[model samples]
Target chain A: MALSAVRAPKIQLRQVRKVFDAHEQGMVALQNVDLDVSANEFVTLVGASGCGKSTLLRIIGGLEYATRGDVLIDGHGVLGPGSDRAMVFQHYSLYPWLRVMENIKFSRRLQANRGELTSSEVEAASGRADALLNVMGLSNAADKYPNQLSGGMQQRVAIARALLPRPQVLLMDEPFGALDAQTREVMHDLILHVFKLERATIVFVTHDVEEAIYLGQRVVLMAPRPGRIDTIYRVPLPAQRHQDMKHAPEFLALKREILQRIRETSGMKTDLELLEKLSHSVSISSLRTQG
Target chain B: MHNFSFSRPARRPAWFAVRGQIGRREYWMLALVGLVVPLLLWWSLSASGLVTKVFMPGPADVWNRAVLWFREDDLLGDIGISVYRVVAAWGLSALIAIPLGLAIGTYRPVQALLEPLTDFIRYMPAVAFIPLVMLWIGITEGSKIAIIWIGTFFQMVLMVAEDVRRVPMAQIETAQTMGARRSEIVSLVLLPAAKPAILDTLRVTMGWAWTYLVVAELVAANSGLGYAILRAQRFLQTDKIFAGIIIIGLIGLLLDQLFRALHRKAFPWLYLR
Candidate 1:
C-alpha cells in the first residue's frame, strides 16, 4: 500500500492566520502559525481564552478556514471537512435525541453512503461501535440519551463517537473543560488509553496547562492579542507517563518554566497600569484646578 | 464501632401516595366547593324568578338536556366526529409538513424562497379562508380537511424550521468532520437534534388543528359536530348548542392528555423535571 507508505505529516498548518469580526471588534484569533503533527503524535495547544488555540485546532479539523496560509492533511490541501479527521467539542456535543449506540453508528452510516464500504462493512463498523462502547465503559448506557448520562459519561460517548470512523487525526477543543476535578482526572486517563489504542494523531486544545503537560507529547503554548505560539516544548518524559509524574521535580521545573513564559507573554499588567496612570493624571488635574 | 438504637414508629403515607382511589380528598373538596358555590348562585337566581324558565332555563333544565343528549348518543357522536376530524387533519398535515419542513430547514435556498410565503400564510386566519375554500373545494370533506391542514401546516413549518435551525453548529461540524455528506448531516445530526422540538410542534399543532374544525365545517356539510352546533344555533336550540360545546371541551381535554402521554412515552428524559 504505497498510500500508507507516503510518510505524510498527518496534519500540517503553514503560517495560518484567522481574524474574527465579532460584535464590531477586529479580533485576530491566530497569526502566522506554523505547525505539523506526525503520525500518532499527541499534541496539545494551551493558552488563555482568545489565544486561538481552539481556532488553530478548528483549522486543522477543517471546521474553520484560516484567512492566510494553508492547512494540509496527508499532503492533500484541506478544502472542507473530510473523514481523515474527527473532532470532539467542549460541551459534549452529543445529539441528545439519539442513544449512545445510534450516535456511534451515525458515522458508519455516513461512510456507507459515501460508497466507501459495503453494507456488511458498515455492519462491521457498527460492531466496532459496540466494541468502542464497551471499551469506553458505556455499554450499560448505550441505550440512554445524552441527557441521562453524567458529564463524564457524555464526554466518553463524544470521544467514542469521534473514534467510530477511525479517523487518522483527532481534533479536540477543551473536551473535558466542563467536568469536575475527579471526573476530569478519570477522563484524562481514559483519553490517554484510547489515544494509545487508536494510535490516531491528536491535537487537543485546552486552557489547562497541567492537562497539556500530562497528555501531550509536545505542549505548544500560545499567546493572545494576535494569537501566536509562544513556545513549543517536547515533553522528555517516557510515553507511559502517569499522573504522579506531575509531582516529580523535573515535571514541576518544566511546569514552572512554561508558567513563567506564559506570564511573561500574558500582557496582564497593561490595562491595570494604564488605569493607575490615568487615575494619577486625573488627580493631578483636580489638584491644579483647586490650586 | 458503636451501635446506637433509636427506632421511631412507622408513619402513614403522604396525601399523594395513596393508590386505587377515585380522586384525592383535596380534589373532592375542590369539586364540592365548585359545585356548591355555582349551584347556590344559580338556585338563588332561579328562586327569585327574575327570569322565567322559558327565556332563561334553570341549571336543572340544562342538566336534563345534557342527560338526554348523552342517552341519545348525540353527545358521543359529536365528540367522535370532532376527534376524527382533528386526528385526520393533523395526520395529513404531519405527512406533508414534516418532510417539507425538513427540506426547507436543511437547505438555505429553499428556506429563503419559501419563508415569505409561509409568513404570509401563517397570519391569515383559517376561519377567514372558509368562504374561499367553500368556493374552491365546495362544501365537502375535502374543504374541511384542506382548511384544517392549512391552519396547521404553516405553524408546523415555522416550528420545525426553528427546531432544525436550533440544531447545534458544533454537532453539525462534528458530523462533517467525520465525512458526513449534507444529506447525512440532515438525517444524523439535524433531524435527531431537532426531534424533541418537531414532536412538540406536532403536539401543539394538533390543538391548532382542532381550533379550525368549526370554520372548516361552516359550509353545507351536515354530519360533523361543528355542523351539528351550527344547526342548533339556527333553530335557537341553546341546550343542544351547550351540549355540543361541552363535548368539544371534553374532547380537547382528552386530546391534550393523549399528547402529553405520547410525549412522555417517546421522550421520558424530557419530562425528568
Candidate 2:
C-alpha cells in the first residue's frame, strides 16, 4: 500500500469573517481567522472578553454562521450542527428536569431520533454513558439532579455527557471559568486525562493564560477590538504534563510573553493607568469621609 | 472551660427580623393568628350592634345558616357544580393553550401571529362576553363554561408562552449541538426545561378561573355556588351570602393547596430543602 504524503486536517477554517448587523455599521466579531486542527490535537484559544474566541468556536460548531469564508470538517463544508461535533459550555447546560444519567443519555436519544443508531446501538450508548459516568467519578450522582450537585460536579456531568457520543471534535468554551481556583486545578488534570483516554481533537477557549498553557499543545492567542487571532505558540513540554510544570522556567517565560502580547493587543496598559488614577481618587474620597 | 451562658440565647434573634426563618411550630402559630384575628374582629363588630343583622351576619349565625343550607338545600351539589364548571373550563383551556403557547414560544412566526392577538383579547373582560356567550350557547352549562374559558384562556396562553420563553437559550443550543432534530428539541429540551414553570402557570391561571365563577353563573343558572350567592342576596339572606362566600374561599384555598402539593411532588428537584 502507498503511503499518503500529507494528512488532511480534521477541522479547518479558512479566511473566516463574522459581521453582526452587516447592513448597518457592522460589528466584526471575527476577521480573517485561519487555523487547522489535526486529528488528535489539543488547541486552546485565549483572549480578553470580546476577543471573538467564543464566536469563532461557535462558528466552527455551526451554532453560528460566518459571514464569509469556509469552515471544513473532514474536508466537508460545514453546515449546521452534526453528530461529529459536541460542545461543552461554561454554563453546566444540563437539563434540570433530567437526572445525571438521563442527561448523559440525552445525546444518545438525539442520535436515535435521527435514525443514526439502531436499537442495539441505542442500548450500547447507555452502557457507554455508564462507563463515562464512572470515568467522570459521578457514578454516585447518577440519579441526582443537576441542581443537587456542586458547580464542579455539574460541569463534570456535562463533560461526561459530551464525551458519551465520542464526537470527533470537542468544543469547550471555558468549561472551568466558573470554578474556584482549587477546583479549576483539579479539572485541568481531569480534562487532560479524558483527552488522552478519548483521543478526540479539542478546541478549548479560555481567558486564563495559565490554564491555556497548562492544557494546550499549541496556544492560539486572540485580540479584541474587531477580534482576530494574533499569535500561536507551541508548548515545549512533553506529551505528559505535571501540575508542577506550570512553575518551570520555559513555562513561565512563555506565559510572560503571551501575557505581555495580550496586554499590548487589548490596550491593558492605558486601562491600568486609568485604574490607578481611579484608586488614588477613591482613597482621597475615603479619607475625606473619615475626617 | 469557662462557664459563659446567656439567658434565652440572645432573645432568639428577634422573631420578626427581616428574612428570618421561623420553625414549623412558629409558622403554624402565626398562621393561626392570621385567621383568628380576622374572625375575632368580625365577631366583635357584629356583636357590638354597629350594623344591623340584615347587613352583617355574626359568625355563629353564618355557621348555623351554612349547616341549615347544607341539610335543607343541595349545598354539596352547588359546590360540586361550581367546581366542575371551573375544572372543565380550565382543563380545556390548558389543553388548548399549552400547545398553542409552546408553539408561539418556540417559533418566532407563531409568536408574531398570536401574541398580540392574545394580549388584545385578554383585556376584553370575560363578563363582557356574557351576552354573546348566552346568545351563542343559550343559557346552558356550555355558556357558563365558555364564559370561564373566555376569561382565562388568553391570559393562560400568554403566561405559558412566557414560561416556555424563559427556558434558558443555553439548553436549546446544547441540544442543537448534540444534533437534535427540531421535534427532539421541542420534546426533549424545550418542554422538559419549561415544564415546572408551565405547571406554575397552570396553578395560577386556575385561581383566575375561579374569580369568574359569579359571572359564569350569572347567565340564568339555578345551580352552583355563584347562583346560590345571587339568590341569597335577593331575599336578604345575609347569613347565607356569608356562608356562600366562605365556602367559595375554602374551595379556592383547597384547590390552591392541592396545586402546590402537586408541584412539589412532580418536581422534587426544585424543592431541595
Candidate 3:
C-alpha cells in the first residue's frame, strides 16, 4: 500500500457514483466509491445482491458509465471499453457457435477486423491461444462447441478467451457463482494460478464470502440501499496461498467478521432471528392441532 | 427392495405426459399414425357419401387423377415451375431480409427507420397486392415472383430482426469488453449468435411463401400447380383439383423437412444431447 502511494495505482476510482433511472425515483446503484488497485493486485468486491458490486465492475469495464465521478486506468479517464480490459461474466458469455479454440482466438478476430493485426501476428495469436487452452486444462476440449462442454469447462474457455488479449485489467463478475462447491474450489485455484501467471490486475465480484476472502488480496465489502463501499479489509495472509489457508485462524476470523458486517450493512435477519420472530408469533403445536 | 412403499404414484404414459420425450422408434410410430389417421378419416368420409365426390373426391379417385396427371399431362413441368417461383421469390426475400433484419436488430437507428414500415407493409395482405403487382410488374413471370415477394419479404425482415435482437445481451457485452466495435459486434457477435434462429425464421417464412404461392400464381400465370388448380376449379375438375392440392401439400412438407435437416447439419451444437 505504501509502495502504491509512491507509484501510481494500476486503476483508480474517484468518488464514482451510478444512478439507474429504471424506477421513477432514479435508484442509486452506487455512490462515493473510491478504490485503488495496485499493479497485479487481486481485489474482490463482496456484498448481498443489489449492492452494486457488479455494477461498479461494469463501470470499470466501461460497459456502464458512472452517473457521477471518474474511472481511471493508468491515470487516464475511461472513454469506453477498450482492449486494455477484458471481462468474464458469470455464465453463457462464450459464443456458442465458435469452438473452444476458435473462441479463445476471438479477440484476435476483432483486432483483425479493425486492420490492427498482421498475418504473422494472427498466427502468433493462434499459437498463444493453444498455450492458453493448455493452461486452462482445456486442450482436449479444444475442438468442441461450448454447449457440448460442462458449465465449468465453458467458464474455463471464457477465461481463456478473456486472457488472450493480455489486457492490463481482468474483471470477473461471479465467474464461478453457478458451479457446484467442488467445481467452485477448482475454479478458484485455476483463476488464482492464471492471475499469477498472467500478471494482470483482477477485480472479482461475488456474494460468496469465502470466495472473496480466498481469492482476493483485499476484500472490499459493499452495502445495498443506495449502494456504497462499507469497508476494505487487507488480507493478513502471505502472498502465496493454498486451499488449507482458507481454514486458517486469520482467514476464519476475517470471514466471520465480514459475514457479520454484511448482515448489519444489508439489514438482513439471520435464520435464527427469523425463526425466533416466527415462534413468538405462532407455535408449532398450534399448527399441528389445526392439521 | 425394502417393502417400505405405501402408495405408489401412477407413472405417466410417454405420449401424453408433460415434457415427456419418446425414443426415435416410438416417435416414428406416432408420426406414422398421425399421417395415416388423417388420410383414413378423409377416405372414410368420402366413401360414406356424407359429402358429394364433386366437392370432396374419394382418395382412390384423387390418386388415379394424380397418376394420370404425372404420366399424361405436364404435371412435372407445373411442379417444377411452382417450386422455382416459391424458391426464387423466397430466396430473393431472404437475401435482402436476413441482412436488413440483422441491421435493424443490431442498430437502433436502422430499427427506427425500417421496422415500422416493414410492420405496416406486412399487415397489408399479399393477396390484396395482386392488382398493384399486376400494374407495377405487368402480367408476366415477374408479377408472380413479385406477388410472392410482397407476401413474404416484409414479414421475413421483421422476424429476422427479432431473431437477431433475441441474441443475449451478455454475448454482445462480452464482445464489447473484448474491444469489438459496433459493426464488429453485429458481424462477429450478433450474426453468428442469431444464425440458428435466423435459419428457423427462414424455415417458417418459407412455409408462408408456399401459402402465398396460389395468390402469386393467381395473376396471369398459366403453367404452375396453382394455375392447374385454378383451371381445374373453373371446369369443376374436382379430382384434378384434389390432385393439385395434395401435390402442393406434399411439396411444402418435403421443403419443411429439408430445412430441418439443414438446420441440424449446420447447427450441430443446438442438438447436443
Candidate 4:
C-alpha cells in the first residue's frame, strides 16, 4: 500500500536543453532546466525577450523536442502533443472558417475520435462548452467568426477553446499580448478567476513583471542565451484577488524583486554601451582584438 | 479619455437616399464616351471612305446581320453548344485537377517528382496541343472537350497546388495539437483553408476554357459559335464575322459575371483584389 501512496506532479521537466542551428549561428535556447508543477498550481515564467520562456512552454506542451533531457506528464515521457495538455498562443490562432462554438468544440471532437468518449459523453462535453462560453462572457458571440470579434473577445474565445479539452495543464504563451492595456488587465483577472474555478494547473509565460506578480502563484525568472532559472518567488496573496491588491505592499515588493532580477539578467547596460560605440566607430574589427 | 459630443441629425435629401441605388456616375460617363466616340469615329471613317465598307462593315450593318441571324438560323443552338463545351470541360478539369493538385501540394516528394512535368506542360502553349488532340480523338466532340481540358487543367493544378501548399503552418500545428489525424487535418483544415484560392483559380481557368473553345471548334464539323464564324469567313460576310465576334465577347463577359456572382456567394470572406 505504501508503494502506491505516491502522487506525481502534473508536469515535470528535468535537465532539459534545447539548441537551434540558425544557419551560421549556433543558438542555445535553454540549458539544464529543472521544474516541477503541482496539480492545480499556477506558475509564471518572466524574462526579457530571447530568454526562451516561450520555448520552455512549448517543450512542456510537447510541441518541441529538447535536445538533452526529459519532459514527463503524469509520469509518462512527453513525446507528442496530447489532449492532456493544451496551449493558448499569443496570436489568437483560432481557425477563421470556424465559428466560436465550433472552435471551442474542436478538441472535444478529436477526443471523441480517440474512443475516449461516446456520443452521449460528447453531448455532455458540448453542454460544458456552452457553460464555458457563458463564463468567458462570449455567449452572445458564439455564432460569430473570429474576424468579427474584437481582439479581447477573440482571446476570450481562444481561452475557451484551450479549456474545452479540460486538460490537466494549460500552457499560455503571452495570451494577452495583443490586447490593449485595459483589456489586458481585464483578461488577467478573468484568467485568474477561471483558474480558481477549474482548478487546472497553468504555466503562463510573460515578459511583464507586474503581470507575472499578479497572476502567478510562483514566479520563475529566466536568464537569456542558454536560458536557465534565475529566481523563483512564492507570491503571498489571497485566493480571490482584486485591482486594489496590486497597490498593496506585498504586490509592490514582489514586482520590485522580479524587476531587479530581470535587470540583472537582461545585459542591457553592457549592450547599450557596445551599441553606442559601434554606432560611432567606422571600423571596430581591429579595436575588438585589443579590448 | 475624451468627452463624447452629441449633435442634432441633419434633414436628409431625397437624392442622398437614392445615391447608392443608382449606377455610379463615372461608369455612366465612361459608357457614354464609349458609345459616342466609337460611333462618331466609325461614321467619320465610313463617310470619309478611308476603308471600303466591304472589308470593315459599320456597326449598324453588323447589328442588322446579328438580327437576321437570330431570326433566320438557330443561333441559340450555337450558343448552347458553346456553353455546354465550356461547362463540361471546366467541370472535368476541376474533378481531375483539384485532387491531383492537393496531392502534389501536400506531399513534398510528390511535388518534387511532378514539378518538372507540371512546369513543362504549364508553359507549352495549349494551342500546340490541339494537333495532337485532333490526331488522338479526331474531329469529334471528345477532341474539343479534350482541348479545353488540356488548356485549363495545368493552370488549375499549379494554382490549386500553390494555394494548398501556402496554408499557414501555424494552422496545421494547431490542428495537430488538437489530436487531428492526418486525414482529418487534410479534410477539415487544409481543404477548407484552400477553398477560396481554389475557387479563384477556377474563375481564371474558366476564361482559358473559352479561349480553347475557339481553337477546338476551328477543325470540327459544324456546330458551335466557332463553326458559325468559320462559315461566315468562307463567304467573306464581314457583317456576319463582326456579329460572331461581338457575340463571343458578350458571352465571355457574361460567363465572367456568373463566376463573380458565385465567388461572392461561396466566399464572402475573401476580400476581392
Where model 3 places Cα greater than 4 Å from the true spot, the runs are A1-6, A22-24, A118-120, A269-291, B1-17
lDDT of 4 by residue, A1-291 (tens): 443324777788999999987757778999999999988999999997888999999998888999899998877899987777888888737877788899899887666666888889888999999999999999998988888888999899988998987888888989888889999999989999899988999999998888888899899999997788888899998877788999999999889877866777887545566577787683576578678
TM-scores of all predicted structures: 0.81, 0.93, 0.91, 0.83
Clash pairs (backbone) in predicted model 2: none
Cα error, residue A144 of model 3, in Å, equals 1.3
| Model 4 pairs whose backbones collide | none
Which residue pairs collide in model 1, if any? Answer: none
lDDT of each model, Cα atoms only? 0.83, 0.91, 0.91, 0.84
List, residue by residue over A183-267, the lDDT tens digit for candidate 2. 9999999999999999999999999999999999999999998889999999999889899999999999999999888878987
Query: Native-vs-model 4 lDDT?
Result: 0.84
List, residue by residue over A1-291, the lDDT tens digit for candidate 1: 577647768787898989887758768889999888999999999876678898888888888888889898877789988877889998837877777898877777676667888878877887899899998999899888888889999999999988988889999999999999999999888999998999999999988888899999999999988899988999878899788998988788888877777766776445566578899999999999999
Q: What are the clashing pairs of model 3?
A: none
Model 1 chain B: weakest 10-residue lDDT segment is: B1-10
Which ten-residue region of model 4 chain A has the weakest summed lDDT?
Answer: A1-10
Q: Which sections of candidate 4 miss by over 4 Å? A: A1-6, A21-27, A111-119, A227-230, A236-239, A248-266, A270-291, B1-57, B230-241, B267-273
lDDT of 4 at A76: 80
The sequence of per-residue lDDT tens digits that candidate 4 reaches over residues B1-273 is: 233445745533344454544447956887789979987897777777788978888888888898888888788888899889888999999998899899888888989998779888888887888888889999888888888888888888988899999887767767767778888788888898888788878888988888888777876648888778888889998888888888988888787888888978876645422
Instruction: For model 2, state the Cα shift of residue B73 in Å.
Output: 2.3
lDDT comparison, 1 vs 4, better candidate: 4
What are the per-residue Cα lDDT tens digits for candidate 3 across B10-127?
5445576678777899899989999999999999999999999898999999999989988988899999999999999999999999989999998899999989998988999888
Displacement of the residue B139 alpha carbon in candidate 1, Å:
3.0
- The residue-by-residue lDDT of candidate 2 on B73-98, one tens digit each, is 98999999999999999999999999
